[model samples]
Target: MASVAEAYVFLTYLKVLFLTVTTYLTCTAHNSPTRPMFSVFTSYNDSLEKTHGLPTNLSWSQLASTVGEDKTSSSCQPVGIYSIQRHGSRYPEQRIITTYQTFFSRIARSRINEEFAYLKNEPLDRFTVEKAECLTDKGYNELLEISARYPARLFPLFRDPVSIFTQSSFQSTETNRTKESAEAFISGLCKECRFITPKHDEDKLILVMKDGKIYSEIHWLPILHDPLLLPKISSGICKDSIAIEEHSREFYSFKNSPFVEEVLHHVISRLDYTGDFSMTLDELQSLYEICATEMNLFGASNWCKLFSQSDLRAMEYLYDLQEYWYSSYGYRINYLPYCVLLQDIASHLESSVASGSTSTKKIFKFAHSTTIQGLFALLGLYRTSVIPTADNYPLDGNWEYRGGIISPYAANIVFSVFRCAGRSTLPNAIGDVKVLITHNEQPLKIGPCDSYYCDLTTLTSYLRSKVGSCDLDEICGGVVRDLPMKT
Candidate 1:
């Protein structure tokens, strides 16, 4: 009923307000490309409605043609390769909590809660969140669907009716996540999946040598429980948590402890080994001899001065101390106990795989975002030293609030699909196993691997800069791989 002049004036004022406020704020973080991510209802576009275009492959008939892959008109042949991949995007539902504890422990507890929220909503997904690694409920469904959609890309072991397959879980010996992820995966697999627990003491594959041996490995797994125990850090710690919890003890000490690695790090840090040069055995030993007295006199606080005197690799020593010093000392100071029985569970898994048939058994490891990034040297993913514990809750529900095109935290599921490839070596033909990442994201404003999922467009942009072009397929590395090529 309004006049045309009045309507134009009203629309003009609204447009002015939108441009000056909401639109500007919302669009600040977006990097819209020429094409939008998804398209809908394009069959009649070209003939009836002309402005927009459809994806090149869109057609009802072609879509139908591709539907029956798992249902072929032909007989199946044996192709028994197994490959591993992490789970797709998920988010640990974040929550605010309240508690008072040491920083690290507190962090662990809160992060568990965020993950707990995820499980609460998505209970059917397998994976328990207690320990260091495991999948979530959404991750459980996502992987099952991923395999179903891309069965051709999946290892042959996963698709076989006779094959025993399930995901590997990563649990830090905590509580909820481990049990939950395993349950989710088991429900989906509907087959008994073997569990591979990590060792209590894990050795880092720091370098692969010219002799083709995997060595120079510094361990990340040993300090907690039995000397040789390697708890499947993931494998979703069992529902019998109470059974192994006593074994899952952590140690602490205000006084200096006798862990030799702690002493060595202290002395080396004091001397400042940048890692440009190696230390002699006697020098290493003598330094350890002096470390106890020095640490006893000064707490973990001043232990670095010992390396202040070393000009050799001063920077490198500082770097090592920067990275490993706190952990080493924290381990010694805490005298934490590890879950030996839990570790046995991990070993049991390795043994199970060793004993299974090369052609028949398949192992799938489902674990956390950090477990994969930390181990793989993914220079891209972000991790924090602060573990989020239950105590981090703000008094108000409005803690750390943000809006207007905010990017969310994405959780990943990493799979290490293990297949028994040989008979004589205890299923030891290991080099053939593969790894891949699957994500449903574009680029992030913060950048690649910004969220748990690798931001493909950022990686693509980075690679394009290095290669002097933007064609993603032409080079070896982009921000993210477009499609995993089978080697």
Candidate 2:
């Protein structure tokens, strides 16, 4: 948005409180002595079983049994939700199914009718990256079949109208990549889903460009700019080498070195600049400063939102993530400004429901695993290293890139939904999140894989015991875990 001073004082209070809370909680979390962590102790009249944290699994009948226990009819509904899933598989080839002269050409004609955006000064050309944004036919069909298979997955919560969703995508929001995926998903419930991709491919998952009619270029970098409350570093890679293929392996080694930490810092300094700036040789330094400033505070998206044409930056999101992760509450790397917004969203949803709104109205955020990992790292959810990175990165690669035999691009992400108080325990409105690993609805991995109905009760029992006096809104409060910024 050009300007948003609406919450000037509130924003100021939020910023200071956030910084102070983060600093204080983080320090306490880190320094606080560790307690032998334990799950809630729930007893099923006959047997006793113990379980770990969320992304855990349970059986169906067990849940039915739990409902029977709560004959008193508690205000909070007892329910569980899951990660919509498919199976684990390789990313198939696209050339065999579709071909194009250059990836850049594909960006110009993205599925999300960007014509309107182009006319608004946020020209399509400006959005254009050096590459394309479609998925391969195989990739396209994969998501389609997934949609058809799990047509009933979300039907319980959103029968007809659903507001927002968070999905994971890789290798360019390629027509085939994002479009095909969106189509396959929406077609399942006969809901008209829209893929509003722009001509810029750099912001996509994987981007390929032509290098002087010779070798094709591939860029794994993305541009995340948020103007206000930005970072001290930049996400987008340097542009002087768009013709990256021309550089030899030896040449790139020097360019890719992380020794140039200051170089990154320099690019982040200009986020939220009020001055009217234009591209020019001298302005390179200014632009670099903007990027560096933003990166230091937020990531590229924060920079983009402030400077980019969007009226809103990252969509307001909600996360039911735990607070005081384990014990202390030190600010974790996941304490990025983006997450603050998520907490805000969750708070909003909770408030909305306290009054009156469609109970089933739910929103999902398709964000990077790093977003979660960062928080996990901050909160000590899991080992910080679980984020999947080698410490050093290849030149022009995804910052959150994690590779392996599985190619590390399975759209690994955290899928969470919001449930109104009335339906918290409802089968469809279960507020729990499911952890899955698959390209389609087929689950390559499913939590509660072993725990049956009895196990689920144990989980609730565990929550009641271990979970502090915090309410749902407090749970969403940035209290779960606090670690230093890994970023």
Candidate 3:
């Protein structure tokens, strides 16, 4: 019953008051010293549980809370979820293990140098390389935790008990880590369900080459004719000896730099390796790996103390360069493998829409970190324009935004479909289905779709175009013989 003029004035006052309060809260939150920031490594004095990278792998729950989206709106519901995840922490490779043990043995036997005086009486136990290529107990726990938490997050999407189909790409007797990771996740997710054994579907999941013999199975149509697959499309693909040697040279050349030399000297002195000994690039790499592996297994190690924060950051960048050029976004051809995966994702989404309620609710794939990295690059997520170089390593730059974070142990990329109840101008709206892509629990802002939640039809069209451009026969002709294959 109030007058129009009075009501307008009162509403304007309320709006102004609301804006003022919101602005104050936002400013307060931004300026608060207690606010948490993402850190790549914990302080030397901090407990190993606080470490965030390579060694002492981040727990899935901690990662999810730090980077994951907030609770979805009450109205928005998840219809389907597709996820591809990497296995968690594991023992180092045989060569790395040997190098670490040898290095430590030398240190233990070295006449107590002033620099390494602390280790004079410190009982240095020799490390043995056991259970190589197998998941550590911590790795198993990580997947288990993820399975428990992810379901609750997606509960609103499907009120019913959602069906899960798990797949893994580990085929070799030596590489059971992927399969174990998948089993652990399933155990956590469906406690009552039996563990499903993984099938070796090379034609669908992997590209293998042995002794110059290539077994090319074009799983995804988009990569069919892609020329990038021509260069050893198997485990050996990433092991390009020439490329690794070049990278090693670049890394070693930095030793001549005064700053690097000073840091190296300081690190060597602290580790008690001073006195007429110069560290080779190979030695430095081995030392870093030893630090990482020790921390990963035992939660703490003296090796962690040998390097400062700046040194760790530098080493991380070195690793970034290796991973990038070897099998990630930096390599142009790497996208071919993941483009196929994207097509599969598109197909699954299409089926979900076509079948409506009858479609599979969840699709889970377990693979190596390489798979996640390739997909991340193909999707152009967390990519930087400035390519890293040995001399121009951007220490002050956003290194945390690179593959180090994108492909951490147990890293995952998730695509979630939500049936939004709304109207849209696009054709085949089908109740305005939207898809959200998240890497490592954090939602990605896909540039192609230009939104966090992309319209299904638009996303589908883009993915189909990618798939349509492939001609597998042309790309894999040398190895694409008519073998009895299952698609």
RMSD of each: 23.9, 23.0, 16.1
**Top candidate, metric TM-score:** 3
Better of 1 and 2 by TM-score: 2
Model 3 lDDT at residue 74? 26
Position 483, candidate 1: lDDT: 33
In order, how many clashes per candidate? Answer: 94, 102, 7
Q: Which candidate achieves the best lDDT against the true structure?
A: 3
For each candidate, give its TM-score against the true structure: 0.28, 0.32, 0.68
RMSD value for candidate 2: 23.0
| Greater-lDDT candidate between 1 and 3 | 3
C-alpha lDDT score of every prediction, in listed order:
0.27, 0.27, 0.54
User: Which run of 10 residues does model 3 get worst, by summed lDDT?
Assistant: 36-45
lDDT (Cα, tens digit) per residue for candidate 3, span 412-449: 77787777666643454356677777666656667578
Misplaced by over 4 Å in model 1 are 1-140, 150-152, 166-174, 189-361, 378-487
Cα lDDT tens digits for candidate 2, 19-83: 34422221112112321011110011000111122221222222224435222222223221323
TM-score of predicted structure 1:
0.28
- Candidate 2 shows a clash count of 102
- State how far residue 438 of model 1 sits from its true place (Å): 6.2
